[model samples]
Target chain A: MTSWQIIILASIAVFALKLAGYLVPPSLLERPRPARIANLMTVALLAALIVVQTLGAGTRIVFDARVPALIVAAGLLAVRAPFIVVVAAAATTAALIRLLT
Target chain B: MSTARSSQHKAAIRASVAVGIAVSAYGISFGALAVTAGLDIVQTCVLSLLMFSGGSQFAVIGILASGGTAAGVAAIASSTLLGTRNALYAIRMAPVVGGRWPRTLLAAHWTIDESTAVSAAQTTPEGQRAGFWWTGAIIYLGWNLATLIGALIGNLLGDVSQYGLDAAAAAAFLGLIWPRLKSMQPIAVAVGAAVVAALLTPALPPGLPVLAAALVAVVVGLTNWLGPKDPLPAMQQLDLGEDGFP
Candidate 1:
């Protein structure tokens, strides 16, 4: 399939998944375990994304500016800095580091 | 009605708008990155409009960028998996977003992280409604608009990496999940999954590593080992201040 086909098909599938939740029998979801698992799965996926974005370099793990920059972002988040602040600071930190080295 | 109650709703709405604006600004990064990742300006905006979930949107671009054209299936699978939480969120919000089929259908489109966090933060049903709809509408409008702007800007940039776009993406994902790390169990799950994914990144394809890492959450969550005595989904206890910003 072409890029357009892939994107269009994926978008529709995601929407359908979202709608399925609303239409499903609440009794099945009410079990709580499924909900718990779903929530945990989200965390897991996000954590994986963070690692991949920051370190993974196409089948190779390369240490680079993103590591220190991510740490800076974490520090800001720890202090309760706003969302935009963390993101901007991270980007700026990486940019500065890359420029210097 | 009590003035206090009205004020409560007002606060929720205010926060919703603030979150809307904040989350919407992040769309610029996505727009720029998506364009740089080979998606045209129109495709970028279409994604923001249709998928509507930030994590899923980012995953599509990120996977495609990493694994090249052959990674199309992985991109779709990873993006869909990311949307799983939204589906779960829908089940939780069904009662909160009650209406006819039409309204609920529309609500499903807006069933995203920021709206859910803001709504769950409220003390009253009216406040929840206000928070959900207001945040959803603001983000929906602002994200699409910002995507266009970012796409335009991305066309001018030479290299996104020099400007730390990659780092920003990582930081954004980190910040998004930061709020959900309320306890030891989820923290362990997050760390476990990260390690697993990192280890598998060199071995498996781009998107498969993320899918593989999901087992960490499933096993830990199912076993209830290193979990809380009361197994709550954590959505009901969402503190809006720390929630994953869309």
Candidate 2:
């Protein structure tokens, strides 16, 4: 299928999911699993995104200075460093280490 | 139900849309990277439009380019699996939209990362709905436009790193994730998931490790290892009133 076709199909599917969620009553959403899963999903999704970004350097998982980048980024976040500083520090650290090592 | 609340709703909508714009612009990095990786303009845009899920979109293209079809499929599956949470957001947000067809369409498009966060943060039902639609529309339009522009300019650029475009989305994502680490459970979950994802990276493909990490997070939260009661505060408990937005 063409990209447009794929997009249209996917859009429809996503819309359907939204619609289903809308139609379902809120009481159902109060289920332990839904609530539990939802909360878990939030943190997990963010973690997944971060992990993928830090590890996958153009298709391969380079465990070089990226590890240090990850650690530094997490530490900065832990210590409440400004967002831009934390990210710039991490990326610059990674690149410099890559160049050096 | 009240004018004051409606106004607050409007304000929340504006905030969500603004935040959406700020976040969605980061997609330029993804668009540029995808094209640099050999994906056509249409293919990259379609991933954004169809997948509409950022992590999965990146994972699919990343794996497909890496010659890891099986791993790519796994990544896509895992990311989509993690994406199930957005549906839950829809459940909470549906009441705010209240079956208005135009609003429903808006809600459908706006059910993304930023909008969900905005909606969850609001107290009033009206404000929540307003946030859901406004933020959703902003992200939808902003992301598409950025993707198109990024594809055009990104295709012309030699190395994306030269422009520092490669780190833009990661930076933006970190900005979003960093602010939410309020307490121990979330902090623990984030740390654990990151560690797991890192450990799995060399062993798995681009998306799999993250997904696995997310799965572990799910288990931790479900088992009360993450917290005792709900981590998210009940913003509605105070009876902010039908018209009061706070």
TM-scores for all predictions: 0.91, 0.73
The TM-score each candidate achieves on chain A is 0.91, 0.64
Candidate 1: tens digits of C-alpha lDDT, residues B2-121: 998899889988988888997898888788878777788888889889889988888888777677657788888878877887887777678898689899988999998888888888
RMSD of every prediction: 2.3, 5.4
What is candidate 2's lDDT per residue for B1-246, written digit by digit as tens? 488897887889778766776656656756765675456798778777666665445544444434344454454455455456556667767777756787676576566656766776777877776776777777777777777777776689756444443343344345555655656776788888878877777776555676678776678756858475754432222111121110
**Model 1 ranges off by over 4 Å:** B2-12, B233-242
- State each model's CA lDDT, in order: 0.83, 0.60
Q: Assess the local accuracy of residue A22 in candidate 1 as a C-alpha lDDT between 0 and 100.
A: 89
CAPRI tier of model 1: medium
